[model samples]
Target: MFKKLLFCSTLPLALVCGSCSSLYKVDKKTYVIEVNNQNETFNNLSKVSGVYEPRKTLHDTLTGNYLLRYKYKNETKYDYLNNYFYKNGVSAKFLKFGIIDEIHLVDAQNSTHIFNTDEDSQINNVSDFIHPDINRGYKNPIYQIQTNNHNSINSSFFNQKLASSKLIRFKIKNNIYWYNKDKKTDILINSKDIEKSIEKANLSSQQTNELKAFGIEKMDFKANENNSYFEIKLNGNFKAELFLDLIINNKIFSAYSDKFNYSEYYLVKNDLKHTLYKSVNNANDIQSVLIKYNAAGKVDKPTHAKHLLNEYHQGLVSSNLLDDFSDVQQKQLIRDFNSNKGIKLSVVQNFSNNIVNTIMFKDFIDEPDKNNIFEIMMYGKNKDKNSQISQFYSQNNIDFRNNITQIINKYTLNFIANKTNYYDNFISPNAIISNAQNTNYLKVIDANDHVSKGQINLAKNIEFYPQDLKKNYYNAESFLNVEKQLKSIHFESISKNLSNIIDDFYKENSNLKNKKINFILPLKLESLDTRIIEKLNKIFNEINQNLQVNIVDINSEIAKKYYNFSNYSTNNTIEYINKLLLTSNNNLINALTNSNVSQYKILNKTKQLLNKFIEQNKITVNLNDKQFLEKMSEFSIKLHNKFSYFEIIKLINEIKLLYSLPYNLSSNIDLDSFKYELIQPWIIKPTREDNLIYFEDIKMEGKNE
Candidate 1:
């Protein structure tokens, strides 16, 4: 019995919990509430109990109007009314009551207050309160109201006359027309107008072809009274949308008209081909015009107009002084134009092009072939400061100075020793030999270790000397010859080092991939003695098959000969000779070991054996040729002087000094910086000769003459 009583109590509690957990559905009903100007009546259109809440009043700042906020409740619980008035000349009061939205507006006199509300299903009913004449369709009522007010404000400000009937304004180029929206009339842009505009544009053939491809010939404009919009018709294989986009975004079909006027404001094209807007009225009113243009989508932003006008005025002033300005003044103007942060980079680039063209043209008119424009602009006075070329380089972010310094540092030896014409004057073996004779020859001295008053003779007298004296002289002569050979080997080792460095530079530096450095030896290969030629050919052939070292006639026109030392090795000749002697069929060892013969006979037999060995091995060089010996001696001295470390370092220091200056041909500017086609005429052409060696060779080595 106790268990049954407990079950009964638990069943009641469970029943209560189940009832609490079950959801109760309530039907929601939307109410359209309207408040009149006097705020007197609260008519309950829907007979709901306690639906209205206490109202909170607010004031509008524009027309001193009043708004009310209310809270209420439905079956689903809480509901609120949100209402507020815009604080502007065009006042709008918005109210959200329950599930309904409403808009209230008053005229300028505050005499009438209009209120309209829409249910959640028909939300567009409230827009009727803002403007009853125009059908806003799907657009926001607030935006339409603001646009109408803005149009009115602009019309009043600019003194524009409006017709009594609603009219649509169309602006094409500088021509403006008005059409009645309600009336049906023939308004069209014919093919003749398009043809005339195209003709007036003076478009290029490419532009004409582009237009033709766009179906410009089939394009026509006509007014659509039903839709109240202008219709653009294209009949050919063209997309109307794409044509419209091109017309709107690009200057392809632009009319040549540069000046546009509306009431007191006018947009005029400046000398820089930039359009600038101004007002014939008060200057302070220009900002208002810009604002109006911005609102109408005529301008992007008001601040952009100010920037454009600033640039346009600067361009105008500079253009006026083009003819009368001196070179100094023009240069100063270019500097000023570039330094102005307010100016756009594109505008600055255009100004640089103009200034450079003017200066170069004037310079050419005054003098040609004497003063390169690059020299006048880069190396002239006041070059340290910014100029047209400097501005162009800076804008492109090209560090010519750094690039040139790197190239110079890498190829210092080539710059000093690689000029063909300068080789005859700067690198003479005779001068070096004469100087060495004067400084190194033995001088006669008295007992006190001072020079004697008698002249010292240099001729050898070994023919009349005794056998011991002759043997000593011969040993001394052999020692001197060995010393000379050692010197020659030392020079060849230095040349090898230089060649390796050059090869590495060529492989590593990508900037020099297309560049070539020519080393034109003064001696003609064809004019050299046959034995010397053969030895040179053997040396060239045995080093490597890379053909790095080349022997051509001095007058031959070999294109782009970069100094290459890959076909050279210090021991190439010696190794070749050793190989030839070891593998040859001649009896060279027997000739050397012949103790039965006299010394002269041994020497003669050794020469014959060497000649026979050379023949057998197909070696072309002769060891006993007088002309060959003289030519080889001259070449040895020339090579020694050419690879002198002291001379190379001196030239490197001079190059460093030249590059360290504020301006030079390589470090200052280049034609690559000026991308404009109009400036191409002023660009100096590089000669094949100048490109072989860096142009600085002509300047520094005095080879320009």
Candidate 2:
């Protein structure tokens, strides 16, 4: 019985030992266990742990190495182990026993660490260790770890090797950053590097040409020691300040490289056709910048006018259009428009010079107020002559019914009337406004006002003056009266001159009375005054019925030759030669006789002679050099000497004789007939006696008989 008991006990003990050995078997596979924690001390402990657990007990007891991948807001840690402990494994009892706050599995083959935390415990003081190779990877863990702060591990971080490489570094606002990499680096960017990059940049032909035109090749760029700022040395006429703003504001540097990306800095380019502006912020880490360039062929009259109108309508008060206008004038225009008082426009069309003058007034029907009026004159190419009015209308968009008070043709009498009105009211007209003599209109208005002040004296050209007016009744009547009076005077003078000429012809050739007498007159027969023509016809009938007269214009070639030859023989050869010879100076007479100088030149020569005489004689004077010279000038003379007076009288007589000869010789012709009767002067008359007394007396006598 004792032997049987021993055998049974030994068999049971052997079976129990076999089962325990199998349950405690160790996992030899490596594992990468990740854990996350927000606690600062835990993160610090992980960082200090390196290849081992931070706590001494854990480091002594754990089986793997530990590493803090990176420390950020929430800490992430990686624990690598070659050997993993299962829930029922021999090392699992240490974690469950909770002797330490955290447990790590240490791989004896690789010496890597994997973290395992015990519930309701903390890590105490631990020693630091060497950092492990973060590039290593591992298999799945025996027991999967779960934590609240864990994230998806970056495959690149584990796969890629950590090595230093070349990178471009730049600073914006004194903050340095890597160009190829998002993180900061010690590599700094200098101006030379930027210049090289720009040189090697892939720029379009247009962009390159623009830069060349801007004189970029003449510019030298240098950076500060820290490369926080850049200084550009300008050469030639290159404007550094302007270019800095242009390049930075237009983001032109971005065309050089793709790595340039700064969030706080940017550029904008604005092209408004007439003007261009580029804006940049924090250029070269310095101040912000703005650049402007005005385009060519801009701000012309029509364009400027259009801009002014648009700006005015948009409530803008100041513009280049108002530059010439005073503040008061501008205010008047603005006030009238704003208050709906209305503006008046008068367009004077000048077809002769192909110009249109636009006059603006403060109000419609307002009297000529120069202060409230402004004028704009438009000139254009000949081809665009007819488009001026259209352009004005298009630019201004004025209301014709309300704004157009009058449209005056510059050549018409109405323009003269308007000008006179302005003058009469003591208002100075604009430069574009011109004055003219409208005799008919002036006569009526002046007569109504009982003022003889408006008559224009044009006695020099009586035939051309007081132009006939057929449309105006009052003007036609007045014109007829003037025509009759002028014709009567001319008729009497012409009749007397013609009668004397014919009488002389008869007296000289009495035997040729039967021959037809042909009288060639140097005047336009058709244009001669009517009264003179009628009187001449009467005289010819009374003198000789067969007499015939032929009229030729004095300006005609034939008439001009005849008159010139006659004057040369009668006046030039006789009177002029005699006068020249009579002069005291032999040099003057010789000069006049031989020189080819004109009459004007002769006058100049005479002045020089007089000056020489004065200089030679040393004439008495109490004056400075300037005053003496001025006194010697022809314009300074107030009185004429006896010889000068005689010469002037002779010249006047000669001119009158030459000018009036043609009209006097050829006055027997009519041009235009008067359409209205002349007004006779008012004459006083005696009071008429009543004829009823004689009628009554004859009736009574007849009844009594």
Candidate 3:
């Protein structure tokens, strides 16, 4: 069976009743954010006829806010207040009507925050407190409901139900075993002995009595028509649900406090063969004793597993930066949890260019305190170029939001501008219009193509038509230039608006310095031809004459590195050698083809290798061949077709030696010294020569001397 099991943790907290005021004094700037309100907490709140605050309460004298903290009966119980104004940086009543029954998040006149709920009446004050600029969550929230109702639960009911009844499912298999809670000998049980196993299993007197009365239903051990194995189901009574512990053979398997169920049994599947189940007592205990831990918050280079994310987005692999999850870690986590093997944090941050863009994670196992909140601390060179680090706490901190906006804006602008820069500088039809290829042809055609108007009457005004045509050509060019100017203006406008928004955001909170705009320019290389190379040489010669242009013959490089006769021919070694000198049919007619069939195959492989290199390197071929550039074009193409790797290297060295001499042979003041200083250093001379053939003991003259 191919099944994808998703493990999710429902965070549960206690529901304490809070009294409401009759005359609600709604402050304009105050906003209320709600969390974890779909379980029994909402149910309990709906049942209450009157607003009732519990007797015991803690009042913050400084902030005029009351915090109702639940005393945890045990370690698993959560103690955070059911309702309290999360502390504001300033001692102001930012949450005026703190977490009311019909919560409305108000802000001055433009009240943008609204919490969606099941009951039309369920909505009042609760809102999601994400960064105002981040319109969507990093990943959308996925809800897996058992029933078809698919209703959004209210705050109080969700909180209470989640605390008591949460279910975790695991798949079991035949011959599967587990180590005990105390790490003793392996305990194995069959489907028939399951009830007897529970009876003899480790449990307190109260738990034994509870299990006996609840009674383990005789399991359907006979595999279904599909031939799948049995599943384990946990059934907890109301009180047992709070401190429910699964003890197998004096070993605690699993425990849950906030685990509750509307139905009696929560099912676990035997999804795989040879699966092992865990008999651990506490979740925290399992983590510490079993898990091979990777510590949190260490910045290091992380490895990524490949995933085909989307079909629509296709670009150069180097161009697209992705924030992807590690499928290896995720699969490992799932396998461990299902096999009763323990689980660990497999958190990964995906980034490009040293900027952390996305973070993916599994669920948390810990309960929370009032102080429990997500905090991201960023430290780098600030806008002022000062060495400093800044801490941004969630809620009541606008500095964090401003900084986040800056990062998003800067990155997005750079992405758009990079593409535009490529088009404007090189690819666009109108780019470098003065150097356009077809302009001379257009002028020649205009001069030659003329109409004889001797038959036309003088009064017909034919000259006006010619004038109109000329005016239209100039107008179109002007229009294109205007369009380019407008695009440039639009980019400037967008950048200015972004800066203004950032400035206005920090106006009230002026502790932050303005961010510096950093533009990343892509490293670009132009297509090579003889003319371009000569022009580059002239520029280099003026600046530093020692530089020389070298073109490596990729085909020869491939042949030299890797060539075997067996790779191309299935014939015997003797036959392959004989075929090298034999004549080939008309099929071998390409530029690099020759009379020999075996040699042609080798040459074809070399050509294929060179083409692959060209694609990967993003090399474009120059095709702007004017009359003056015809020689350069023919020479470049000829070298590509005729020369092997070593032959081209030899040609370049020969040209360097020839160029080293002055225009007049006798003009050099000291020929030997000039060769040592200017000529020999540029030449890669062979160590020894035999019968005009050079060997590879190449050395530069200046370095060796």
Candidate 4:
């Protein structure tokens, strides 16, 4: 018997062989097969016969049919003498060796065969032939069927390819969109390009629907998420621009926080490049473009305006600057006037209409416009007292009369009412007593130091003013005194007003502990004068007692610690000790390692050293000679025992370097002292709450009158 391995290296190997006289020469090929194995195609197996008999013995084997056998290496096992035995399993078949030779299955077609090798089918027992599961396991028909099933599963599992989406990039030439090196031309737009890609791109579903109610068209591309391509099959060709919008996951693309760059997609029409225009909506969505189609700038204004009006009517866009007539509304004012000659007259007519509707003096019940009131007050003050204001009105063919009470209400009381808001809201909130001059009319300082022109003060008893009335005369010294007196009264008024607001705020919140109130008054020593301190004390005392608000004075405590160190007291020494323990770990350990102290020296002072280190008082204990040696001994043990022997030696060397510095802090302290204090064995108790105001200073500038 002769065994020869035949591998497919090149197609149709040379038929000549030296051992042609050998009988039963089996041709074997190597195949390694297991679960989920990758199969490779044999390129040289194209020339072979149809079939061969596996058990057929032949002389002159060069002319005999080719027998195909697959061999795989199996795990080794040892026998009784402890000798190793190498085994190989084989699946052999004699088949037609030729190009594209298909196998014929002759088994029970309904039954499937699975290869199962038993452990007892050893080479040593092969001659015994007691077990039929190995050599005589199945018939030739069943073997053919199993081989066919194996080949099919291996081909399907190892050779299958998956499908994926292809990216198609295009560029526009003139108005045509071209793909693939200009070999293909395609129309990329639908009628909904503007409605979907631009207008409805940023609009919410409800907003889009609302615009749709007004005959606006919108296309949603979300239905094509699973489709490989947006196949635009145009029946009859019409001109389509190469305009594109980003479609992600078949939805119109959006990036909320970043600026979406669409500049690359804009096409140049004429001399200008046209990009998608963005109009911000009520929902703050940037609707990309408003026009349904791309149009140049020649008539863009009118077209855009019309679209804007449409969007506005549907409540998609609001706050158009021309919603009410103003001078800044461009030439839109001309659109309202029917005749060119009455254009100026129309302006005056609109003004008069607004005045007639808005200005009313009788009853003086409702709030008057303070800005208009201030204007009227200034206008009335600048007018002549000898002639009537109606003279010019009659000359201009305008029949208008200013009511006496309305003039007084608008120009005086109403003007002051406007000023009162500024004083109450801004000045009172910040505790500011203003000294700025109001030079339009006779400036008067009231008893409360509230400064306004006498012409505008309705509370003043002055019924009328002279047209030539100049500012009230005053000597510098008396003016200064009165100003000072008025300033004090003004501060008092502001304080009272603030108190009232605070009281009201507390009441309105259902008296929930107003956690929002935090007042930290940082002051210096120079500002701590008697009067200012008293005033501040009174204010804060009232706030703390009534409002249930307490402001911490951490600065004063720090200041006291610094300025009065003799009387100063704090638990910060322990904090410092704890920090030293953690932060000085490396250096302290090194110092102890190198020190010449004995183990007993360190242990003896462990407790005493820790107590002294973290003492709140600044007193330092004087260590006796014996105590010092004991502390050093304790220090050496505490550090030396904790680490490895090599680490201890290294720490000792590092400690030697540390002691060479200007000061040796750890020279007297034991390691146990550092360990105890550093770990922070004590807890800090909270301080009792009290109604004491701590501050450095409170200066009352330019003393109160």
Highest TM-score: which candidate? Answer: 1
Cα RMSD (Å) per model?
A: 41.1, 48.1, 38.8, 45.2
Compared with the true structure, what per-residue lDDT tens digits does model 3 show for residues 1-705? 011011112112111221342322211111111111122221121101011111110011111111111110000111123222221100100111111112122233433233223342322211222221122211111111121122323333333332333231111233333333324234332332333233344444434333332222222332232222222233332222111111110111211112221111111211211111121222211111001111121122232112111100110010011223344544654455346442212111111121111110101111212121221112122322111111111111222222222222221122222321110000111111111111221111111111100011112211112223223323544344422222221233333443454344345334433332121111111323454334333422221121122222222432222111112221111112122212121011121221122222344453454345446645443223232133222223223234433332222222212111111111111101000000111122211100111111122222211
**lDDT digits (tens) for residues 1-705 of candidate 4:** 010011111211112222444222111110011111111211211111111111111111111111112111111121213221212211111112111112111122323222122111131221132222333331111111112223331112111210010111111112322122212335332222322333434554433332222222333322222221112211111111100101211122211111121110111111112112221111212112111212222233444445443333222221132323333333443342223321211000000000100111111112323333221221222234211222222211110111111111211111122222111000011111111111111111111112211121122223222111111112343243422211221233333443454454456444333344332222332423455334434444442333322222323652222111111111111111122233222223222323322322332243344445336333332233433333333333223223333332222222222221111111111111000000000111111111110110111111111
Cand. 3 Cα-lDDT: 0.21
Given candidate 2, what's the lDDT at residue 704? 12
What local distance difference test score does each model get? 0.23, 0.25, 0.21, 0.21
Estimate the TM-score for candidate 2.
Answer: 0.18
Query: Can you write out model 2's per-residue Cα lDDT over 1-705, one digit (the tens) per residue?
Result: 332222112110111112333332111110111011112222122111112111222111121111111110101112214332121211000111111112122222433232233221221101111112223321111111222311111112211111111111122223333233223345544444445444654454534433443334433444565434222222232332223223322222321223432222222222321111111221221111121212232333443334444333322211122332445555665466445453321111111111112112111111212221111111111224223333222212121111111111111222122222111110111111111111221111222111111111112211211122112313444344433322322333334433454455456546555655443335344444666445444433443344454445555764442233121111111123222223222112233223222322324344455456457647433233433333332211211211232332232222221112122221111111111110001101111110000000010111111
Whichever of 1 and 3 has more TM-score, that candidate is 1
Count of clashing residue pairs in every prediction: 0, 8, 36, 29
Cα TM-score per model: 0.19, 0.18, 0.15, 0.14
On TM-score, who's better, 2 or 3?
A: 2
